[model samples]
Target: MKKLITATLFATMMAGTAMADTTLKLVEVITSPERTETLKSIVGKFEAENPGTKVEIISLPWGEAFQKFATMVSAGEIPDVMEMPDTWLSLYANNGMLESLEPYLKDWEHTAGMTDRALELGRDVKDTAYMLPYGFYLRAMFYNKKIFAEAGVDGPPKTMDEFVAASEKISKLPGKYGYCLRGGPGGLNGWMMFAATMAGNNEFFNADGTSKFSEPDWVKGIEWVVDLYKKGYAPKDSVNWGFNEIVAGFYTGTCAMLDQDPDALIAISERMDAADYAVVPMPKGPAGKSFPTIGYAGWSMMSASANKDLSWKLIATLEGPEGNIEWNKRIGALPALKAAEKDPFYAGEQFKGWFDELADKDAVPTVMPTYLEEFAFFKDSLAIKTTQEALLGDITPEELAKQWAEYLTAAQQKFLASK
Candidate 1:
């Protein structure tokens, strides 16, 4: 009788211990080996601080993350927390999948330290805090100093005319191209930047909810990129190049210039020498202004999370001052906290171009039309196909502009009507 009682008590104790432990599921959509390492390090500290909690990380490749995450949610495999990009926030938040972080933010110790821009962007969806943004991604020009010197170019271009002149000069060099054009996936930002700069404004739609992409200046802008490729200024094989290909092109010296967000710096800085290249603000247009695209990503909790309080605690740990700085260091984005900008890491010469852009009166940081529910499809599917067609000479630049304008107009009008 005594032996049986002891066995039963031992079984009960094990069950109680198991019940005491909690495991939170974390999904990272922008998965990279370095990013994963940083995330794990931060999460390790969180786990250490909370004795009875563990976080299970699920990383999905960025290319297929949108669709894969959506499918997972639909199939009832939702995570406790996720890395939410600017483009995917509305889709999940509007569909009631995300838990508003406003309540938690009010009580968080680091809330006061967050930059106003971070809070503003976090409230992008329905004016509620569905996510706590970690950092900002602003586009800037990266130029190969070695390639420029070889081509006899004096410095980075400040104007569109100068940009073209430099490209022409660089293309004359043996087996060299001027621009690492991302003509495949993730090329929409380049298209938008060029069009907005040429149009002298970052306005996407007019008073009547019509897209401005079909305007003459916008058409000219699109044609200019097409002409760059046609004139052999961009690599012939670049029509199918995506993010990785373009970055490779820049570092390998196949191309002289690349306009990319700061996240790219993480990868570029790894393989290239600091003195061999330099970052600069995107060149201006005829109107003496440049519209560089700005984007952000954040940590969000799911509505279905059973451990809401614990999930919030994890979020706070990741987005808090020290954790945020550590994450952004690995992620290569501008910190979202006002205080973090003062960190010595951001004061380096590589970050000078982005800071200069922010200070420049003529450098407009343009936000994408990500509020539209159909924007993901428009950007990942419709835009890619049409832009590729234009790049390949299968469709004229005017046709490409008109198609984009019509699609965006419908989407914008639908969004406005729903409001």
Candidate 2:
């Protein structure tokens, strides 16, 4: 009997030591000052509670995240866990670069708190879950409330026509650009987002993944935008506006409207009230519906990781209901955790409204699979160059569309080979 007791005690001792000695290396592509500070604080809290496991964090900027991740993957300097971009997930997952977490996630309790849409976005078409999604990148319309009231617009316009009309009214105001847009990178810069907004307008990439940017409905849509700019409703520098420029333009009240991610609003100082600022669904165009870009940002554990179990535990902790809510609060993020999304931190109806509507993909397609072609869709193409030329008044829209069609045809063929 004594021998049996000793044997059991020895086994228990070995197990404890094994768990205590485990370590995990984690990487997060830090994007902003606020996010960087939050990352440090979270790591400290995680380490304190999770004894025996030390997380070696390596911060990489988002601008260089993809290239860095690619290099590490080739060299096998792969961390135990990584936070990947929405578009890049498909590229990694398709190549088997990431471990499938479906089996392990099956038994985890934290999933109950996650939003269904977030789950769909984080997983593959085969129902294989890859990364645990952290936040939403849903589209929203940010209108200057002061401008709205002065224009006699009760609130944001609900339909595309009304939106255009409101912009016309607002553009006449002193020192205000009715809208701010992205251009220079042209098609490369805004095609996907244009797909979403056009989705709101019931426009789309066809079954073959090709687009006719010059179709009457689509042409009309672009014409409206062009007219808006030609009339000085949109800033001339719009051709060069990137994510950074748009955010600054909106916050400074230089632009009257912006179609951007939800976090853009949350980035504003909290002292501002919903009355002064609120988000509306992307306006519907003549197509009777509008689409908006919904991006996923998340982390997945490596299958070949030496410390798979420990890495999963750390991942589970960060994506857990409580942890998700806290991290989301510090940033302007909507929690992927369904329960966390409902927490008091999200506040009233205005914020949660789109999360509820858009999560189901009723308004638009749900879970745009992450892919690399999305980045190259418009790169170095004639359509893009022509658009830039039009912005410079060197070409006509007709000539621009003709050139774009040619570039898109060739680009699509190369991209379709992999599909």
Candidate 3:
């Protein structure tokens, strides 16, 4: 009897070890306190559902995430699952470092409920599903109602000219600027939006695969923003401001207008009263169209993952209708799942601005050239340097535009050649 009991105990111990061996590592690069908390909550549920299967969560600070994640991967310390931003998708997907999620997505119970845009962006790298996008970041104009009223401006600007006029009017007020320009990191989107609006279309490349940024219309768009800074319409110090600074500027009533994605709402709503602010579609330009930049971040499984099925299961749990909605509620992005749109959370007045932009024929959602593997470097380094110079009058808009056109043209052509 003693011998039989010992054998049974050993068998039970081995079975427990087998179950404990299924440990999955997840890294979230867009880390925020709220986002991390919500992620942990969702992951906790995932862990609870799968007994003995542990999920190790790593939250990387957004500022150092790119370089840090690259180093981690190179050092052979790869996570099974990762939060993939659009800018990083091309590099990893093209390098074959990411697992194609098409097969899993095909059989996912909630796959049909994903919006078309979500799937389209997920397949952006090589027309293959390397990531499952959780939400979209659509740019819109956030304006302070109190500032507008104080400046005697009637309402949100509807045209580029009106936007500038309102800015000038607001600038005349003591200690107030018209626009909270994101002139530092992550400013590329604003520059692209203005350039495309003035260029009369959101087309970045011509038939010959050359960038159209150096064209006269696009140059004017660049100049228009440069002039806004030079004329004191925006805070002089804003030339060094980034995401946090601009959001703070808007909520503090130091700036009358800010062009940002829905995520800004999370911060802005916290500081300012609901009645003090509102959002609107980006102002149209001479062609009567506005091109607001749209971006997204999603979940991607690493090709190096030993347990593909388990990794995919984690992705599905996070991106499933309930998990996705909960995540976006904290992240402040539009849900990638179509059914999540019906939730009362999105039906609020604040979200009306983005929904209205979606319905407006003249409001174009401009997607950046994220397919180019070199784009992350260009946006994070090259564009920031040159745009700051342009804003400070250290370089002419024409010079800046020419440099951008050359860089983008080369990148796009190289991408085309690879295909």
Candidate 4:
């Protein structure tokens, strides 16, 4: 009789444990079909491991993500977790929108894997830790192995001088543009057009909380980038080409080199034979240090989430070694995980000739959220046609810089007020 009673009590306890498990309405703003599929698979495993919690991912492209989310945030319909770019973090945080992740980060093992730079980059507009970095992207040179061989160059360039010489060599090719520069497209793809100018100038709004964007050092840098567009090396239509057109140009042999993010590497390799493509570091400038544009992608947990603990558990697995490899593989993104640097997927000739800057432990965060306006001035003043005409001898760089300073002064007032 005692054994029967004990068995009944054990069954009752088991039923209670099952009921405690709950469903979490997780909303992730995934950008692509491939990434959506990858995330779904990752979430599925988490649900299986931790019974009773359902993670529902709400995939949204960059375009649709923001506008739709604005409504949700206003309606108090925030997701359990979501993804965002580090640069936009300020706008959200300043509006009293974001929940501080500092409370949970204090003892989380996965959050511990994050580096100092990662944490710094995730700081809110107020310079407080408000989010966690989930993934990152790096700007690099994508070169055609065939083009390098034809130009009599054995490998990629190491310095500013080597880069200029190589571009000139590639110009000798009958049908190809020497080095490619993007034409502007939508606001979302605008980064490619402005990256070269930003790196060459070492100018990204003032790093010290000032609006010194038109400072002499950065002005000289814009002068150089404008010259590239007017020289006939970068295609005339580049300003309007968009990412698709640029990718098409690289694939069709119209251009010898492209400045783009590493996330495109997987697509580049998959589209053609692996032998057709290789990547290198973005070239150095007057500063004498190789600077490639860098940026962060972030993830955050909602303060109001009923299953907050379970949500972080899912985050841990996704950021952990196994899930990161799977997710990074699908999207061609680099995992912030240090061990991912030496992943076997990055091995062999496919990654060869591109190993020089593979692990950018030295990369600086491309731009903080504050520098958006400053970045705009350079692109309008020099990257696009407004400055292209001046670079081509249509107007002097001196004249261009003069007009640029006026715009910078006006913009600086508003930008500074926010700080």
The local distance difference test score of each candidate is 0.92, 0.66, 0.93, 0.62
TM-score of 3: 0.96
Better candidate number, 1 or 2, judged by TM-score: 1
Best candidate (score: lDDT)? 3
Give the per-residue lDDT of model 3 (tens digit) for 1-419. Answer: 99999999999999999989889999999887888999999999999988889999999887668788998999999999999999989989999999999999888999999999999999997789999999999999999998899989999999999999999999999999999998987899999999999888999999888999999999999999999999999999999888889999999989999999998998899999999999999999999999999999999999999989989989999999889999999889999999987899999999999999999999999899999998888887899899999998899999999999999999999988887
Question: Number of the top candidate by TM-score?
Answer: 3
Over the stretch 1-419, how does candidate 2's per-residue lDDT look in tens digits?
99999999999999889868776778886376777677667777777887767788877765456567667878978889887666666666766767888877889987766778778777743467878888876666777798778777778887767877888788777777767676643223344444445434433345565656555555555555566667787777876665667767777777778876666665654534566666667666555666665666888877668877777777777787666777777766667876764466577655754665475344563334234344323433443566667766777655665555555545555567756
| Model 3 stretches astray by more than 4 angstroms | 1-5
Ranking by TM-score: 3, 1, 2, 4
Stretches > 4 Å off in candidate 4? 1-30, 63-68, 71-77, 124-127, 151-155, 159-175, 185-210, 241-245, 303-307, 346-355, 358-419
Per-residue error (Å), model 1, residue 311: 1.3
C-alpha displacement of 253 in model 2, angstroms? 1.2
Q: What lDDT is obtained when candidate 2 is compared to the true structure?
A: 0.66
Per-model TM values vs. the true structure:
0.95, 0.78, 0.96, 0.73
Give residue 388's lDDT in candidate 4 (0 to 100): 46
**Who is ahead in TM-score, 2 or 3?**
3
Q: Write the per-residue lDDT of candidate 4 for residues 113-142, one digit (tens) a residue.
A: 666666777774566666677666666778
- Distance from true position, residue 134, model 1, in Å? 0.4
Give me the overall lDDT of model 1.
0.92
- Candidate 2 vs. true structure, TM-score: 0.78
